[model samples]
Target: MIVELKNEQFYLCRHLLNRQAHLEPISVINQTNPGRVFVDDNTNPTSGMVWLGNNDGFIFFGNPHNEKFNQYIDPFIDQFLVEEAKKVDLDYMEAIGNSKDWNTTLEKVFKKRNHGNWNQRVYTLKNYEYLDKTEPNIELEYKIQKLDNRILTSVDLTNLDTLKENILESWSTIDDFCSKGIGFCIIVDNEIASYCYSNFVAGSVHCIAIETMEKYQGNKLAQKVAHTFVKECFIHKKLPYWDCMEDNDPSVAVAERLGFKSYFRYIGFDFSF
Candidate 1:
């Protein structure tokens, strides 16, 4: 059965770590140190899987596909979180996800915190099939090669002195998550022009922020980098997930051109912030 740790519990911690080891590594999840919440049929209190990390809040990571754990264990884990929230006098707790099963569970437990309706979020991407037919002209080729060269030469941020101030200032901890996957940059005549990266969550890969220098804005390097990144994700057997503010037209266009289909949309509730 599922168990919630009242305090530090070593065995439950081990089980959670073991479960993470078997799953496709998610960098965002890895960066957080949120402790464990348990699951398993073993009568021993320490046995079974535990969900680890805190995104906006706690994350549940146990195998939903396991028959015994899925049926007997997961519900209790859900109940445990809700009960714990009440016990701690938490005004609100929320879970964010694109999964129907997760939404169903959250619907039953979390009081629909997105107001009257769940947030409408979309995921879209273009694959290699869409990208292959597009040929870059001489100008486009020059820009793409410039970007490729910049990324290859300055794999780390330190060597990119000219771009360092702006990049480091704007970089997100989430960027570290993107680094765990594919990252690329565009350079123009030895100058860093633009760059993009992907952050993988389970099999879903989301493209992180792409930025172009003011001088490079009209060159379409952002589009090229994005297309290349999506191609890489597909080659790696990962689905590239593109999420942007609902009003972000440029991002939406890039994702559409790259062959990403809009799947679902979500709204965020930031109780913590």
Candidate 2:
């Protein structure tokens, strides 16, 4: 019998999911602090698990597959976040995927609901090294340069609103990011030129997401901030994971520049109920 989990069981559940995270880190975001956790075996919540992070749902292969999951779980997930989930926010209920069973089940369910597909690609850092010393081939024009490492509860991007709508909107709130995630920003004249932070973190792995203002795109601010973020990841003994669309040249370029290697490719579907 599947049981809904409580805070007391978080440790055991996190342990199970963390082991699986080593293989599919992207699939197991925020498992350590999920909003809800369900497991077939209470003794080992990780053995057969479905974790509902703030917005994403995760499936793990532990116990034998059961048809009851399809029967009862869909409604539980469809109504998981209700109206807020239907909105296309960064932390919105976007996709559900993990092991083989997870992918197949999610595909079938969304198809039955007449939803479309959302394709995605995943990569991992390869022999990773910081870009702090490897400066980009660009002349520095800004007068005030600072690699502010403090996790700001709120970032000052007043001079760079374009980056806010185009990039930061998908990153939830500054307060949440500051408290739960770690980041570095290249502040130029009190404006955020480039920034890098953890979009998803679980266990020892952090998913890195970086954005540079349009005017500062070619100035190497991204490299500097990413270098700091990656260095911190190592300092904390955590691994870093990178994922982006296959056709996004800029992201692919940065990932490669940071020494990230293409490890796995997966699909994501941002469907509505």
Candidate 3:
């Protein structure tokens, strides 16, 4: 009884919004991000799941006890999702459930292929007062720059390909990222050493993703770039969001140092094909 919903049918999933544990699903359902939604009932969906267009992952929302929907989960994964993942050359599937009940359902259904679990932490910046406003002193060899159009689209820019790939992992396209997302980077001798960007945006909230070159890890470049990105979010009246693996000590340290408070925790699962 499951069917893929068209763009117009996306609103039908609204009732299940309250169960969402992350902002990605909201961005997808709102049509502000690219993704596909499948539901048990298109007209009055009681349960549904979103397949992120970026091929990064999936999110499950709505009634966990819906018998019909639960029955379809297996085929949805073993068949439909498997074929779709092939297009992107993905060997595994990563997923998140909106609630504990949904998580339990996913655990049961994916039990055969489930490889591991990820403990994720979500952080919120309630007030700018917690922000460490101290600016990082960069060595003269390193310079910070905005991820502008030139940097986004320039083919010959040093490390631009890697940068674009990382961005597109979360964003649908470089053009879309340029239009809606914000980013900052640290450049060392014309090579990108570290960067941060809005990984997902739902309404006025933006979730941040950051990375630093292995050689540049100890320099606090992530914090510097994130500070710039978050400050930009504030100037534009947007809320900065931070999400990371629970065991990611460096990410946890940076977020906390930036004044973001731990808001919630969620579980993620990876299923091997």
lDDT digits (tens) for residues 82-200 of candidate 3:
88788889879888887777788988877777468899999978555556665577678878889988877666568888988888777778888888988898898778999998878
Better of 1 and 3 by lDDT: 3
**Model 2: CA > 4 A from native:** 1-3, 14-34, 40-64, 78-93, 126-134, 137-181, 234-237
**Candidate 2 colliding pairs:** 125-260
Best by lDDT: 3
Q: Model 1: per-residue lDDT, tens digit, 95-174?
A: 44323444444444434234233353456554544554552333643444322333544655443765443333223433
TM-score pick, better of 1 and 2: 2
User: TM-score for each prediction?
Assistant: 0.50, 0.69, 0.93
* Cα lDDT for residue 253, candidate 2: 79
Looking at model 2, residue 226 earns an lDDT score of 70
Model 1 TM-score on a 0 to 1 scale: 0.50
Write down the RMSD of all candidates, one decimal each: 8.6, 5.0, 1.8
For candidate 3, what's the RMSD?
1.8
True-structure RMSD for candidate 2: 5.0
Task: For each candidate in the order shown, give its overall lDDT on alpha carbons.
Answer: 0.48, 0.56, 0.84
lDDT of 2 by residue, 1-273 (tens): 456666566455554443442333323334323345566556654444454443444444443245655454556655554544546353433554554456676666556665555656666653345444564544454432322224242365465555333323334454544545666667666677777767666656677767887887877677667767777778777777887777788888777787776667666656555
